[model samples]
Target: MSIDRRRFLCRGAALSAGLLLAPGWRAWAQSAPMLDPAARQARAVRYVEQASAAQDDPAYRAGRRCANCDFFSAGQRCSLFPEHRVSPDGWCMSWTSE
Candidate 1:
């Protein structure tokens, strides 16, 4: 087999691009698991699966929920908890309207 500079450069570029995109591709192809209220990250933010369950918290507001939070994505992923998907009706102290 003969090695060529052009072919080597092209292969290197393709490999680099694939490596860079692999994580994003995996993220897009798989749905994140639902957030568990008992999880440490969830507990840290005082997350509740249902907004109503957060009533005891001073930060809870009548109409605030994950679906309407600024950090929430349409796919139910919360920026604060990137590895999990939260319930649309979930509430957390980190919730923000901005």
Candidate 2:
């Protein structure tokens, strides 16, 4: 007699293939080890702004682009730097403003 498909595929239920075969239950499991909640990489931005007011300052230079910054995303928008224009002259803790 043929068996019902639904009954044949019950999760965690053991099914025997034939004589001499050990019954093995079918189940899904995650491949990766679970991570501890306390241990994780977290990115946070404090702030970003332009020093244009001191344009003549000795420290102010044009080569300080955000693209070269560690925090600046390739798209040019900074997470903490709200400057919409996101000028290359901008500076922030999240400044990748290369």
Model 1 clashes, total count = 0
Per-residue error for 23 in candidate 2, Å, reads 47
How accurate locally is residue 83 in candidate 2, as Cα lDDT from 0 to 100? 33
Worst 10 residues of 2 by lDDT: 23-32
State every prediction's TM-score relative to the real structure. 0.69, 0.28
lDDT by residue for model 1 over 1-98, one digit each (tens)?
99799999999999999999988866763577998999998999999999999998998989999999999876688889887889999999998985
Residues 1-98 of candidate 2: C-alpha lDDT, one tens digit per residue: 98788777753255334322432211111222322212222113222345343345454455554556665543344444323334344543433432
TM-score of candidate 1 versus the correct structure, residues matched by position: 0.69
Candidate 1 runs further than 4 Å off: 1-30
Worst 10 residues of 1 by lDDT: 23-32
Model 2: colliding residue pairs: 48-92, 65-97, 65-98, 66-96, 66-97, 66-98, 67-97, 67-98, 68-98, 69-96
Instruction: Give the candidate number with the greatest lDDT.
Output: 1
- Backbone collision tally, model 2: 10
